[model samples]
Target: PSNNETEQHSSQVDQIEEEPVRYELPLRTNRDVPPKRYTPEKEARRSRYPMANIAKGNLSPEAQIFTTSLYFEEISTSVEQALESKV
Candidate 1:
């Protein structure tokens, strides 16, 4: 090889020696554990009073009218739509 080629190769090797070496990160191994099962009585309480389930013994007549009106409006709207499509 020529003297210029040897000098250029030595210059590249000197630049590489001056630069810091790269490193890889270590792998993580930590994980979380889940909670255990729920009891039967706890399940019953959540089921019985699910936000919309009004107590028959506690609701007044006026409140009942409001609830029934909502149901009737929904039923009437569905029925009207069904009838209109038949033609």
Candidate 2:
């Protein structure tokens, strides 16, 4: 390349380098806590699992009955075995 063209290219590069680099602040939320929005997608995903409902204390009557019946059955069985062994 010619001297004049080389000088022009160097000057152009120098001008670019001399220009102040602009740094933008990262996008941030002003609130310390995130806003709670009701998302139908999340609701639908949670509703897809039966255990999630139980976890949230939304037990059906039948489930409550079954759980209590099983608990009582275990207690009754243990008591019966204890009585039989004593006899």
Q: Largest TM-score belongs to which candidate?
A: 1
Report lDDT (Cα) of residue 63, candidate 1. Answer: 81
Off by over 4 Å in 2: 1-3, 19-23, 30-52, 55-65, 70-87
**Candidate 2 overall lDDT versus native:** 0.69
Estimate the TM-score for candidate 2.
0.24
The estimated TM-scores of all candidates read 0.27, 0.24
Each prediction's RMSD to truth: 12.2, 11.7
Model 1 over residues 1-87: C-alpha lDDT tens digits?
A: 999999999999999889687687776444354445654556433565464776756779998778778766533358778797677
User: Candidate 2, residues 28-56: lDDT per residue as tens digits?
Assistant: 77658766776556554445555334542
Query: What C-alpha lDDT does candidate 1 achieve relative to the native structure?
Result: 0.71
- Where does the lowest 10-residue lDDT sum fall in candidate 1? 27-36
**RMSD (CA, angstroms), candidate 1:** 12.2
Best-matching candidate per lDDT: 1
Task: Give me the runs in candidate 1 sitting further than 4 Å from their true place.
Answer: 1-52, 75-87
lDDT of each: 0.71, 0.69
